[model samples]
Target: MKIWNEPYLETCCRAALHRLVLVGGGGRPDGLKDGPCLERLQGMGLARLRADGRYELTEAGRERHAGEILKLRKAG
Candidate 1:
């Protein structure tokens, strides 16, 4: 029942999901924006906090979000 898993991810906030999409797209968050979702993503190795205080998505994160996008498209 990991938060990054599809089931949990489906229930996560759109804002958090949007952040993941941004990170996956090579956009970095500029500050410490720690919260339950971000922390869980970090713990799951999906997102990471860089030494420069920016957040970037890991490769797995990109893949996951890609899959999510596909699912969203199909669901619509």
Candidate 2:
């Protein structure tokens, strides 16, 4: 995770980054979102959410991380 350029996205509640990113896009941070970034990252096999309030990085996630993050992809 340190190797990636992932900006520390501020989440309303601890959860998968997909939900946070989507919700942080000026939308209310509810339990779910109309469009979650999780699905895209999921497609990339880079991120996931557990039953707990945590979004974790997978093996592929480390590889996608270029460590050039200037800002959160979507920050509210």
Candidate 3:
């Protein structure tokens, strides 16, 4: 098995967050382990676990990506 690239965490986290917000949550990529994803996203200020296996967006985290999309939409 291969180790994950650090930058991929940001990208994956954004996609995962969007998926959660879009479809109301779902599964991870096959190779994306849950523990590390949670750790990475939490570190980046985008999410937190409520219970052992449950996660949700932090306010700063939600605004991080939401702010990005809002900027792009405004720019267009």
By lDDT, who's the top model here?
1
Screening candidate 1 with a backbone cut-off below 3 angstroms (N, C-alpha, C), the clashing residue pairs are none
From the highest TM-score down, the ranking of the candidates is 1, 3, 2
Instruction: Report backbone clashes per prediction.
Output: 0, 2, 0
Local accuracy of candidate 2 as per-residue lDDT tens digits, 11-72? 42224543334443242332455225554555556666555644455555544442212134
How many clashing pairs in candidate 2?
Answer: 2
Task: Estimate every model's Cα lDDT from 0 to 1.
Answer: 0.63, 0.44, 0.59
Model 1 backbone overlap count: 0
Q: Of the pair 1 and 3, which is ahead by lDDT?
A: 1
TM-score-best of 1 and 3:
1
TM-score of 2: 0.38
Encode model 3's per-residue lDDT on 1-76: one tens digit a residue.
Answer: 9764434445555666665455334423333455565567777777766554566667866676576545656899
TM-score (all chains, Cα) for each model: 0.61, 0.38, 0.53
Candidate 3 ranges with C-alpha deviation above 4 Å = 1-9, 23-35, 70-76
For candidate 3, give the lDDT of residue 11: 57
